[model samples]
Target chain A: MLKKPRNGNSAQHKYPHVGRTVSLASLSAHLGLSKASISRVLNGAPAARSIPQVTQDRILAAAQALNYRPNLLARSLRRGQSMTVGVLVPELSEGYATLVLAGLEETLSAAGYAMMLVTHHHQEAKLTDLHRIVMERAVDGIVAVDTSLPVIHSTPTVTISCPDPHDGVTNILLDHDRAAELALSHLYALGHRQIAIIKGQPFSSDTDIRWRSIQIAATRLGLSLHPKLVVQMKENLATDEPGFLAAQRLLATGIAFTAIFAFNDVSAIGAIRALQAARRQVPEHVSVVGFDDVTLAAYHRPALTTVRQPLRHMGALAAQSLLHSFTSGGNHEASHSVVVEPLFVLRNSTAQSPALSLQC
Target chain B: MLKKPRNGNSAQHKYPHVGRTVSLASLSAHLGLSKASISRVLNGAPAARSIPQVTQDRILAAAQALNYRPNLLARSLRRGQSMTVGVLVPELSEGYATLVLAGLEETLSAAGYAMMLVTHHHQEAKLTDLHRIVMERAVDGIVAVDTSLPVIHSTPTVTISCPDPHDGVTNILLDHDRAAELALSHLYALGHRQIAIIKGQPFSSDTDIRWRSIQIAATRLGLSLHPKLVVQMKENLATDEPGFLAAQRLLATGIAFTAIFAFNDVSAIGAIRALQAARRQVPEHVSVVGFDDVTLAAYHRPALTTVRQPLRHMGALAAQSLLHSFTSGGNHEASHSVVVEPLFVLRNSTAQSPALSLQC
Candidate 1:
């Protein structure tokens, strides 16, 4: 039922003389109504239905006339639920975290929940302090993105791309095994036998599992994993400098490889730059495949062929799961993990191997 | 001088018997101290120094032992000030807003403040609702990024990249005039006579002023901005598609131009893709310069030569100004605007103009 005004303008125009400082007590006094009766009507409590229609209308009219804005903080204090969630990310400048955050924010906002965001910058001490702060502020739940949070608490929690499993916390993860098979099978079908790999930074939660998946996939394809052909990204940089350096190191090894599978799109772009600098044209000499088809992948010069992780969708799923848990009264038995699939995106970066064509 | 334990482990180990539900009253009862005395000591109020060291130590020890966690929300309600700031941005996936948010979070977190982030998604109705939600949540202040908020309110507010001048809001802006001069002057010194320009999307706050500055800069350089050579981006996409489409439109005009100045790095990349598809090599047939040296700019295929806006620093400055306003009791008179300079970044995308060299 359209009981309230359609827009704020009509209410303000009709009550132009109402002051901003009007309180519930003053409104009750002016209407000659009990404070409890007025509160029940204004809050739309179940008991408000028992009140006569005329009295309810009178209470609503008086509230509109007095311009009594409810103090959400004080009300939340009495209710013991802040209706806010805390989000912790490693950093916000990168593509992965930001994309996930965008999806998370969209869903949370639609559900009428505010988000308190804090970046720990991958510092354990800072994470602990921020967690304490958010908990002190009394958020109803928490969403940790690409962060390791081991402590179990009463707050409903969801973790995205977080490898660590904790009791009473739900995890949103990507299908790393399928991701590996998709990338390796594509490269193998392209007639590339000698392939180099770039591993993610050690600090990344996905690094260990992703590398393990890659090794298993390579073995299943009957491809020998050469130590000299693999290099790991050493720095925790937001830019592609680490990838550029890793590719440079691969070239310096004087090893021959027709294809390079990079850790992410940013690093793939960097590796291509290093290949170009070394006079090896992309696809013409060294075909590169990247992971996580970030927004830049499609616009890149060679148009990076990548494995898409559906990052934003994963973020939205995390938010929905967290909200669901709130309604289910912390029922952690239903699901512990939600795994999302990865798809291979074919772009301009990959082509038939130079060596295979030469053999033909 | 260290009143608290260095780490959470020591306190937990020393107080393992304490229950998690302990409160201030329970701690006072356990220690036979008054609630006022315990609160003053725990909160470090000015009157705490007047209490004897023995009594203060007793209060701290018992509070820690009892696991008394002060409810920040309840305390904030009593103090009438929540140490939380509200941040509104158009979207979170883009580089500009995310970078600024990173800087803002760093500064705000360091000052023991939490941030409530909401994305309006460029919808006026959603923005209005979100604004009301954040305000009702009782944030101490607000920071709006690239958003138009003209409403005059009692809350302390700071805006970044907002062109609209509100009566009581402080604006953190990039010097668009200098930005135009930096890009145009660089192209002019390179002897580019016929240059095409890509204007930002209309929804962008910097689009109008930036285009105006470009026109003024072009006139100062004695260069004519032909309508055929100027194209404005139409779509509000997060990728480089709009820039690519704009560049394609420019090419379809069949006008001869030796250089192109794009709105941003993302669009510049798209424009480069379009030019490459048309067989015009970057810096060979045409020199292309981008704006806002995003993280990808340094790693782009041609390594975009662009203008840097220092977005992160601008975000940090906005946060500091908002904090300063709170400390100064909302003194908006001191500074209405904070203008930041732009720098010209030289890279491989731009070089000596092809037409000028041909003429020579």
Candidate 2:
């Protein structure tokens, strides 16, 4: 498909890969110096030979003018580091994971570290394979994005959004309990009593924590936390399919509820769809809230009210922690745990209880 | 956060990073064979060093039992290949880019190639920096996701959703013309004569192509193509903010259009919000159509009517093209451009024109 651009300006835009193929011999020839002298000067070798300082500066300027970038493999080999960080994600198709990865990449790149992306596809076998490959081969450090695995590498490791840890590992965790409190407290303040909750996938690392936190908070507020009002989704919470199915099930039970607290924005959207299908108007017949204010949360119809977990910020912090541990050569300085707070973003999704509206 | 597992089964699950560190000396001692013979056998040296077949099998079995993985850098150094691929993206936060990247990673990993992820952040300086670093590093092949650049290295390269290539580069285009036709034709078939299009960022690689296709198709169909009805969105089409602002401007223009053809799903969603805010009922007052039926498109309110691109498939094919070129040692075998077709998915967002409703 590649042909010379018909436009003249495009031809002048130098392609990314056409690097300057400058070698020691070329540098030596460009300047009146021997290959050995040019190499010694460029590499900053000790004064084994008395090369004039003026000649050295000239050689350096020529090399710079030629856009000379040192071979990374040779440099890494000499330095005993790959200058790369391995990033492990459970899946790449997820918006949440990808957004976090973008953050990690930004920080890692600025710090002169490349990222090796590895996805486990939520399969134990694939996770094992990725772990073996990443641990046995490259990457100076590792960052596991939203994964639950304990650190087992001799190299420094950091985790994002995951709560568990192992020896010599730093963890960046989201305050799940706080997120629940923010959502439930908001609903409670709005005079909601029979508030239904949509539970996340049962086996997820955060599901129990979030569920227990909500349960505890609801109890403290004297609100009913019953299994009949709790909807269970499938194993994959990222997709809306499980959310759709679970909401449909909740509606099928003929349960009466004035408000719904969905596990995430996707689930909230799904619940809204179900409510619409049943000819129930959102925030008029029932109110809905969600967690994880993803990019789509703000754009969705009714503009989902959700608890936002600074995904990008968490990613950046995790990358910084890994770099610090790897550079410091000890996990002690970087092993400290970081707990990031979640914020409640109010939108049009939730409103006053419909029973109160009817009484008024 | 690190603590002992509450369940006994958790203790049995072996950690992924704790690799069995079996050395050459241990293998030799266990099998009662010399280190030189074992090394030659394990390295698969030719018949010049004849080791017994039984001994070779025994050694291989032991290595497998011990779960030994060879050092990738040392092996690559010996073989003069890095066994890794560099993947470049404009940004990682967008669903489109990350979905394609997931496909690329899947194929590359299956073929024993680790992926080095580089994000240019849509900045010339970052692109230059990434180009310099990747070119100087150890990557056998390259894949640019949603980027347009000429091939600059002997290493094979494949681009996804990008047109206009240089020699020896294979482009995986999305058939933007077809996508536009699919969207425009669908709206036209629905009895909509006055159509407004939300144009993507003017400087994007596909913006012109998509715009031209829409213009040509609209003219061919004898449809009114008015500039007053058109909306110009911000450069970042993946985010909803630009779409929101652009749609607001179009609404402010007071253009009497029955339908809208947005640049992408994000833009379509933003348009929907604007239309709603203006007291316009979708499909009843105005119909909205979008492109690149992202995952959220299906979950969005009114279930966005849009064109779907096979993003993951494109990623896999691009990776395969690069691997084929690199492994075959000739760009000829892999320098074939592939254009994937887009599918039109009908949903609630679009319906018969309001003029038709009045007539009926």
Candidate 3:
């Protein structure tokens, strides 16, 4: 015989004004079972093994019949762990951010953490979004990629390629200076003293660093640094069109150069197109080098010679730092920051400068 | 006079073993105010406007000193709105997925929803991950891209290019058959009867549909698709290597075909590379047409003529479905599914058949 529910007649009034709301207590009472037993079966806890199979079946049937849904927000509040991290990116269509995001996703998922993704195309909106994410406690931590906005919070933040000197923020900076040196040095070795540099955007983190490095390295190697040959992109983002226009600008200047050092692989391909359009053969009329060695870089016509940044590794390290901060109870000091070195990859794009042949 | 919390010293014992946990009640007591008033000030409620500035300042200072957090989980539980959505994708590193994701992010963020991202590389794992996402109540709704996984649950699901006959699940399907007709018809109009097809991955959803359409269109146009000329990739993903290898295999067979229809732009570029290696001039010796006019297709040495799919539009539609379902109280009937058509884009990679040139 089942005992009568104390509030059976008033059960309709208990959760009024809704189209069927089911709670653990309601399901427990309906199935004539304890709330603990219902929870075990519903959550599949270890203690659920002690419950009889018949009782578990009954509980499940009752839950389905009533459309029971465990309140996730309430459960998380009780557990004091959201088990989610916020990821901020400027753009997802770009290969650099997506590649990094892949690695970040892999690591976070392996650690049983979900990633909340938010993108802000404009720079000013990024800070406002960051503030909202923190104020709402939307995530346990944050990892920002290719964003210039600094997370000014104690929310255990990790930034990739976005250096913020703010205390407690761990920055993952790339060694772009080394990448520039490698490209310049390779051009010098190929007997090319006069080279054009298609600089990246003014607002990009790599532009100033790469340009400064190129200048110093050129000076040290006793090579000519012609101001007319350098083409600074007029925009804030690096795309093939800007690269195409930049190469055209360089060509218009008519300063002779045997090689071109592009800001990145897309620009290198664009520069090659401009050269080909002028009836100039790559590596015969001009050898081109690029940076960031995107997937298309390897498949481009001349198979670009570029500097490969460890994008995935940087993403992994950023996730690892945030994870460490979580486990260490928000210390944020254990892994303050990290710097990764870029590598030089030689391919068919670069060859012995045409000046050597002309001199011969 | 600061009034002690009604619960008093036992509050310390209630939440023991933590590094400075501050709740509304604790902050209220510290600031000599009620929890309701403190909540109003912190949450910026209408009642907060009536509170004195001095009292508000005191409350804020005390809360800051105690490192107070509003327990967003509890707040959301009471509000009955998570304001978050889950995004499931096979790969984020792929250009197609990232492009779709950019549009999805734009729409979802504008609608004030956060996206929880998860990637399942293997087909079998997608269902399992979907189950986990739903069971955990990780999001209020879901948008799956390029996945064949059916959203069996009633969690307001929207899928792109993945059709499920199941009720209440909205699918955003692409018109691959029309795209195939467009490509084959173009080649046939150029007086090419024997055509080669670089098929996409065997397991991909579009591969079979596209191939079947190609065969039907070829039959209708009185063209022959030679068995020896078809190259089916072993992998389940499209990339440049397989396209290059497939073109090489066709070349080795010595089968005479004046035109090639590649599965995508990447594979088309690869096929062009293989043709170039064999000293066959594109559009001079053979005409090539690719699908999905990716950004690189335009910048490629011989700008590829291809079919263009509106990936960003599909993404936006999928998001719209999910958002609508949310507003309609998960009815799922508001917008059941959508089918988007692909368009033909003519470029430099294709021209009059080499056979016509030879005859002339």
Best by DockQ: 3
Q: What is candidate 3's CAPRI-style docking category based on DockQ?
A: acceptable
Q: List candidate 3 segments past 4 Å from native.
A: A1-72, A134-137, A252-254, A274-281, B1-72, B248-254, B273-281
For candidate 2, the share of real interface contacts preserved is 0.53
Candidate 1 stretches greater than 4 Å from native: A1-21, A251-256, A275-281, A355-360, B1-20, B252-256, B276-281, B357-360
Top candidate by lDDT: 1
Residue A38 lDDT in candidate 3: 94
Residue-wise C-alpha lDDT for candidate 2, range B202-270, written one tens digit per residue: 545677778888988787778878888887876554577777787888888877889999988888888
DockQ of 2: 0.30
All candidates' TM-scores?
Answer: 0.90, 0.85, 0.84
Q: What are the runs in model 2 whose C-alpha is more than 4 Å off? A: A1-53, A61-69, A248-256, A275-281, A333-335, A355-360, B1-40, B43-49, B57-68, B227-231, B234-238, B248-255, B275-281, B333-335, B355-360
* Location of the lowest summed lDDT over 10 successive residues in candidate 1 chain B: B1-10
Q: What are the candidates' individual DockQ scores? A: 0.34, 0.30, 0.40
Q: How accurate is candidate 1 locally (lDDT)?
A: 0.86
True contacts kept of each: 0.57, 0.53, 0.50
Q: B-chain TM-score, every candidate?
A: 0.92, 0.85, 0.81
Tens digit of lDDT per residue, candidate 1, span B1-360?
A: 001223456776675543244668778778888888889999999989899999888888887776567888778877778899999999986678988998999899889888999988777887787887887787889999988874645678889988787877889998989999888889999999899999988878888889999999999999998889999999978888999999999999999998999999999998998999999999888889999888778767788999999999998999999899888867658439999999989999998888787888
lDDT of 2 at A23: 62
lDDT of each: 0.86, 0.78, 0.78
